[model samples]
Target: MAHPATDDARLPRSGSALDVAEYFAPQRTSSEDLPEIEPLVKNLTIGVLEVLAGVREVDQLARWLGEDAYRALVTRSNLSARARSARGVAAVRPAHRILTQRLCEPTDGVVEAVVVVAGPARTRAVAMRFEGWDGRWRANSLALL
Candidate 1:
């Protein structure tokens, strides 16, 4: 039997489109291009919970929120009542843990996360949207349900 030619046209050659180089090349993604955001979300969510529980003052969240959100939160007169209701049977400082977190990007520089928080006596879902501005994550919107 005769051996096949090493330069056979059927064989893939280096730098060809069929080469695996392109497939293995490093991929660029939005997440990679942007800064890390999940840890910010976690901390912000915890702070929001603390505010809702009245264990933390709304002013403490000011730095994390945008101007509009901060103003709205600060002016809301019912936070104390809501906090009392959420506290339920737990003490002044309830143990809260994140149960689930889902994240998505609605647009560039914006990340939204829906998180479930479980406390000693109650559980609630919190949705927070963050925008990357001035090289930091700022709360664009926050809602509790």
Candidate 2:
């Protein structure tokens, strides 16, 4: 008799046992991997700000955020229409910054962060939460400040 946990038939066709070991290894928490994840963070933050500012619409936010985040953004917009319009960013500067916190459960995933975008007159902080869905990081919720 064989145990289901050790089912050989369900294993990958390629890669040795050591390969599997390396695949699940703990990820590095240095800025070395930051560049790879930068676009997702920056794009989503800018898009959210644009939507709040009325320069962009709600539907446009779907590209960077998940359904829940989209709904949350819409609700926030409705709640404070005047503020969003007044504080709308004129232009985002070239050098925005991202801060990240690694997840505890899984090995390699960034679950949350704060993105700072500098405009002509003001700097806005976009608090974002992300989830690994379909092998990519998708925004789950965002708050504009």
Q: What is candidate 2's local distance difference test score?
A: 0.64
lDDT of 2 by residue, 1-145 (tens): 7787799887667888798887776333433334355567767776676666556677876766778888999987665566645787453223434444232222354467777667655777777776655455667777777
Candidate 2 TM-score to native:
0.54
Candidate 2 ranges beyond 4 A from true positions: 1-35, 80-107
Pick the TM-score winner.
1
TM-scores vs. true structure, each candidate = 0.65, 0.54
lDDT of each: 0.74, 0.64
- Look at candidate 2 and give me any clashing residue pairs: none
lDDT of 1 by residue, 1-145 (tens): 4346665765666677656766676333344456788888888888877766567788877877987777666655255656656767342664789999999988777889999999888888988888776566788788778
